[model samples]
Target: MLGTIIITIFILGPVGVLSQSAENNSISERIIGGHSAAEGQFPYQVSIRVNGKHECGGSIISSFWILTAAHCVARYPLGVLLVVVGTNHVKLGTPYGVAQVFVHEQYESQTKINDIGLIKLAGRINFNAKIKPIQLSTSLQPPGTSCVLSGWGFTNVQTQTIPDSLQYIGMRIVSVERCRAAISAAGLNMPVVDTQVCAFNAPGRGACNADSGGPLVCNGVQYGIVSWGNPCATGVPDVFTSVAANRKWIAIKSGV
Candidate 1:
């Protein structure tokens, strides 16, 4: 039916991450609305600093495990990576501990598919007010629902990374059919794989590299994992790893 929508809507850029917050109220609103999370909800979400160098974000699904995109993992080797939890401050603070990291055996860069990996921490994460795990929904998220995403990534495109304070924005879920049509319209085939989901109405919101593997909390539940977004925050819809689709694999690995 609407298989050609994806091609036509290649990409229109999105606005900056509300860079207009100069007043105390606007700044406070940004803090509360964007990056603020209730204590211990998404505890597994942490800033992954490699060799104490670059900071790539990740999510902890288990006491000893973290899930993140393969692209982020491949940027460096395992031993050089260190996991830092409870990081709201960007440049200062201790980021937990890193024991070992394991990449998905099937991840391939050229395909930009199967982009998932896990990190095994040296020690069980200390459960605390700022450290909590988000619940992964085992079912596909209902379309048209409001979606919440957060990250330390930049507010602008030219920037390559996110700031210290985690920032976030709320968006709506795009229907599967609409998402497929969008891709098809772009001269790409409709995405029918169980691994992906498309969210809707992100006029000025999306992932900018630092948000990989973080939760897409919808309706008070974790629905999706950030995967990819080109020209992020624009017309190109952000793609995610459908939590429902990988339940079996996660269950096998995480026993959840």
Candidate 2:
């Protein structure tokens, strides 16, 4: 009945990472209403740096590959992007140069469709207690299932600065039908395709600026990629790239 809703509501725009903080307070102002993660809590979490600063978050899917939103790296050259793993704090890890960057061939920058991308590390990442690859899910998770989203993004949209350590929050998946209804009620005219998943955003709980390209994990599996949503965790559902929908694309690009 609502098949057409997917064509009419919510095609997300480029979602930025948590903004860089002032010279001071760079590491303590992370995700909105979230808490700090312990070391190895999310071993696959990665910070995607550009020109030596944390610009976005990503997930390690294999020793030599990372999965992130294409919009995060589409504009930057390969030389400027560095993938850092094995650390919970943003600036504490060694930066590995990217050997190659692959944006999905069908990525639509205008609407954020097929927003996934991959990075081939210049050198293989060594796995340790604090660094490892996350498994990718091949099935769709039902709505209302709890998932964990971790990133180093802004805690407040108005402020637009990030925390020192990685932050995480538990969120629930919103049904596609309900998500479309909410966007329609909000008067936002965009598309929500099969490749996208929507996560519920309660007050003070949601991905904000600078949280893009991070991993959205469920049952310890990489199920979603942080894509876009209402600024500042407003009471609207945040959208992600459904990993299960694009698993083949990831496998081909990552060779994992």
- C-alpha displacement of 171 in model 1, angstroms? 2.0
- Per-model TM-score versus the true fold: 0.77, 0.87
**How high a TM-score does candidate 1 get?**
0.77
Instruction: Encode model 2's per-residue lDDT on 1-256: one tens digit a residue.
Output: 0000111122122121223111211111125778889988999999998888787888999889999888778888999889889998988986799999999999987667898899999998899899989999899999988888888887655555678888888878887777766554444545568899887637556776567788888888888887766444545567788999999988887777
Q: lDDT (CA) for every model shown?
A: 0.54, 0.72
Clashes of each: 18, 13
lDDT (Cα, 0-100) at 202 in candidate 2: 71
Q: Residue 138 of candidate 1: its Cα lDDT? A: 84
Highest TM-score: give the candidate number.
2
Per-prediction RMSD in angstroms? 8.6, 7.9
